[model samples]
Target: MIQRAETEHSKELGCAKHLLLAIGSANVIGVSLPASLSSHAGPGAGQGRSVFFSDGVSRIRLTLDENSPVLIENSGETAVLTFDGPGGLISVEGFVEKTGCHCPKQAYITINEGCIFSCRYCNVPNLDKHIKTPDEIASLISDAVRRENVECISLTSGVVGTMQEEDERLFAILERVRPFGLPIGVSVYPTPGLSQRLFELGVSEVKFNLETATGKLFAEMCPSLDRDVLCNALKEAVGIFGKNRVYTNIILGLGESKAEMKQCITHCLENGVIPIIRPLTPSAQLSHFSRPLAEDILSISEFLQSELLRFGLDPSASKTMCAKCMGCDLTPMTDLHLGEVTP
Candidate 1:
C-alpha cells in the first residue's frame, strides 16, 4: 500500500510538471477549434457548454468557448487537459470590469488600465486605457462577493500619471471597500513613505514588483524605475508588514540565469519578503522573450519552499495575495499540507 501510494503521488507530481510546461510555454503547440461557452453552473448548470479544470489541486472556473491567454488543448470529457499560456495556469474566475488581470482564487482588479512606465515585457501601454470610479469599484467588490465566492482581493494599476495620484485613487477605493472586511493586496509603485501609509489604511498585503532579478537585468528590461528605490522599499515593507507578508514579482525569462535567480530568491528571503517568481508571459508588443522552462521554476520552487521553511516563513500563513493564491507559479508552499499527494 505504501509503495502504491508513493507511485500515485509521483504520477500526480509528474502530471503537474507537464501541466506547468504547457501553461508556461510561449508558442502554441496546436490550434484549438473555437467553441461558444455556456454557463454550466447556477442558472447554467448541466449545460455541456462549460468546462472545468484543476491546476494541480486547485479547482479552476473556466468558460469553454472563449479565448483566454491560457488556452486549453486536447480536452477530454473528464476535463483532464493541458492548457497553454505564458504564465502558469491560474484560477481565473473571470475578468473584473475589463482589465487583463485574472482573479485566481478571489478577486484581481485593475484600478485603471494604462501604464506610464515602459517595461520591456508588459503590453499594458499598447492597449486602450481604462479608469474606474471608487463607487463603481465598490459595487464591483459587492457583486464579486455576492455572485462569486471571492475570498480576498488584489489590486493593480498602471502609473495613471504620477505615483501620488495613483496612490490617492487606491486609497479612495480602499475607503469604499474597507467595510467589506476582505484581505486586500495592492501592487503599485513604491512611493516615499507609502508602505506605512497603505498599511495604516488597512491594506493587508502589497507588491511592488522588481520584475528583473538583478540590477543589470532591471536596466535592460525595465529602465524606468530606480532599482535601489524598489529594493529599499521592500525592506521597509518587511519591517512594516512583517516577513512573508510583503512580496514582489520576479519574472523568470528575462535573461536571468540560475545563479541570478538564486541570488534574487535569497535576497527576498533575507529581507523577509516573498518573491513571486512568474514566467515572462508573452502578449502585445512584449512577446519577444521566450517562456521560462517549467523545470527551472519547479527547481526554484522546491528551493523556495525550503527557504521559506528555514526562515520560519510560511506562504500558507499569508493573509492575502499571491503567496495565498499560489496559482501563477509552481511554488510548493501550496502543497506542504497535502496528505502525501496520494491522489
Candidate 2:
C-alpha cells in the first residue's frame, strides 16, 4: 500500500520548489507586477529581438517586447526573464521561473485573452486582449517550429463569448496549422460537445481546466461557473475523448484538503480524464492567498503516484503539453513517482 506521508528529501524538494514559485528567488533578481503593454503595441515583434533564458540544460526564446502579466528576474541559477523595454521590475509575488529545457519541442500560443466571465484568481483581464487572423496564427506556428527542437503546438485562450464561440475560433486556427502535420494540444473551458468537436478536428490532446476541485471552492473562486455544468462537461469529454486523451487542471493551495484533492484524482481516473495538477502561484490579482505548504504538495504528489500509475497514466508518457513539457512546475506527479527525476 502507498503511504500518504512525504519523505524527508521529498519534503525538502517540495518546500524548495514551492518557495521558488511562491516567492521568486529574490537573491537572483528582483521583479514586480508589470503594467499594461497597450502602451508598447507599436509594431509587430521583429526577428532576432527575442531574449533567451536557460537552466543550463534547456533553453527558451521569449519575445518580451511588450508588458506581461508576469514580472521576471534571473535567479542566476535556473531560468531568467528579460523584457525588451524599460521598467522590467515592479513588485509581484509567487513568481517562479519556468524550468528550462534544451531544444524545446513544444510551441505555445494564445488565441485571445478576452473573457466573458471573470474568475477572481484570473489575471488575464489585467492585459489588453486581441484576436489573431488565421494567417497570422499560421505564421506564428510557422516561425515557432523553424527550430528542429519544436515538434508540437499548444494553444490556450480565454472565453470570447461562450464555449461554442471559442471553439469556432480555435477551429479556424487549427485548420491553418493542420497542414504542418504537427500535433496540437489545447486547454480551454469545458462546453457541451467541445471535446467531440476537438476530436473531430483531429486534435492530439484536449485539456479542460476545472481550476479548483471542491464544489464549494469552485463556486467561491469561480462565481460565474455552474458546478453541475462543469462536472457534466468533464464526464462528457471523457466519453468522447477517451482515457488519457482528456485532461483537467487542479490548482493546489486554494484551501483544498488532501482528501478533497484525492477525490478529484480518483474521479478523473474513473472518468478517463487525467488530472493536470499544479500548485498555486500568487499573482498581483490573487496575492491575498498564501503559497501551499511544501510538505503538503509533496505528500499529495507522493500520494497521487500510485493512483495515477494504477490508472495507467505516466507523466513522462503524456503526449500533450504540461505533463510532458514539465517546464513550469518542479514536482508534477506526472514527471515521476516520488520526486525521482527521469532522464
Candidate 3:
C-alpha cells in the first residue's frame, strides 16, 4: 500500500510538471506571434491556433501565440482565468462581458521611503526621492485612460509609514482617482482597516501578495511584517469584497514545494480569495537567482484551476464588468468575453 501511494503521488507530480511546461511554452510562443496574426484570430483561437487539454477534473483551452494568452471557461459560464505571468493565476467567478476600462500609463510615483519589509527576492531600490503630488498622479492616469489604450491599472508602492499611515495614503490615492470611474487594482500591506478603506473607495480589486508559500520562507523574505497580519488582512478583504474581487499574489520560483503552494492556494480559496500565481521575474541586480522553470508555472496554474472547480468557482461567470465604455480597448482578441470595446 505504501509503494502504491508513493507511485500515485509521483504520477501526480509528473502531471503537474507537464502542465507547467505547456503554460510556459505557451507564453513564449504567444509573445512571438505576429501582431497581424493575433488581430485576425477569432475569440477562441490564439494567433489562429487553439490548444486544448483536459486532465480529467478540468478542461483548459488557451491561445499561446502571444504573451501566453489563456481563456479558461468551464461549464459554459462558470469561472474566468486570468494570469499575471509573474504572479499566479486568478479565477474569477460570475464572469461578465463588461468593456475594459482605460488606465494610465505605467509610471512609478515616489509615494514614500524604502520598504520596511526586507524581502530577500525583491530587487526594488529604496530611493529617497521626491514623491509625486496627487495631481501629478491623476494627470498620468487620465492620459493613460483617455489617450493610451489602457484597460486596467495596478498601483503599488513600497511600504511607507507605519501601518496606520500607509492605510491613510492608500485611501487618499484611491479617493483621488475614484472620480474617473476606472477599475483600479492596488497592492498594499495586509492591514484589515486598510482593506476596508480600499473597498469603500470603490476600488475594483485588492492584491495582498503572499510572495512565497512556506511560513518559514515568508518570515525569512519579509522579516519585518507579521505573517499573521497579512493573513488577517487577506481574510478581511475577502469578507468585504466577494472572493472574485480579492486576489493574492504568489511567486512560484522562490524555493517552495508544490504541496506548499497548493496548501497556500487552498487557504486563499477557503477564505474566498483568488490566488494570482506568476513566475519569478528577478531584477537585473538579482539575476544570479534562477527563475522557476516554465513548467512550474503551468503546474501551479493547473492546480489552482482544478481546485477552483472543486470549490464551485467558475471563471466564465466573472466576465469583465465594464463592457459599455469603449474609450480604450484592452481585451485580448482571444478573450471570449470581449465586450463592445474592440481591441
**How far is each candidate from the true structure, as Cα RMSD in Å?**
8.8, 9.8, 12.9
TM-score of 2: 0.72
What would the TM-score be for candidate 3 when compared with the true structure? 0.61
To one decimal, what is the Cα RMSD in angstroms of model 3 from the true structure?
12.9
Per lDDT, the best of the predicted structures is: 1
Please write out the lDDT profile of model 2 over residues 1-343, one tens digit for every residue: 1122232122222233433333322222344322212211101111112333334332222334333323346443333332121222222222333311111456666677556677776666554667777788788677656734567777777766666677788889888888888777888776777778787877888777787879888988888878677678878876776656777778887888889999987887777777866777564346677767656665666666767667776555567566655444543453232533232
Model 1 pairs whose backbones collide: 35-65, 40-45, 91-104
List the candidate numbers ranked by TM-score, top first.
1, 2, 3
- The runs of at least 3 residues in candidate 2 whose Cα sits more than 4 Å from the true structure, single-residue gaps closed, are 1-19, 25-104, 330-343
* Candidate with better TM-score, 1 vs 2: 1
Question: Per-residue lDDT for 131-230 in model 3, tens only?
Answer: 4456767876675566554555556666646778777776777778778765676776766587777777887667677767878878876777677887
lDDT of 1 by residue, 1-343 (tens): 0011211122232235424433432111233323323311111122224333344454323334344344444333222333332343322221111111243345567777767777777766654677878988887777677766677877777776877788899889888888888888888888889899889999888888898889998997777889899999999988898765888888877787888988898888888888877766554445655666666766777777677766666666666666665545555546433222121
Estimate candidate 3's alpha-carbon lDDT, on a 0 to 1 scale: 0.50
> Model 3 segments beyond 4 Å from truth?
1-114, 126-130, 284-286, 314-343
Error of 3 at 87 (Å): 27
Q: Which residue window of length 10 is worst by lDDT in model 2?
A: 39-48
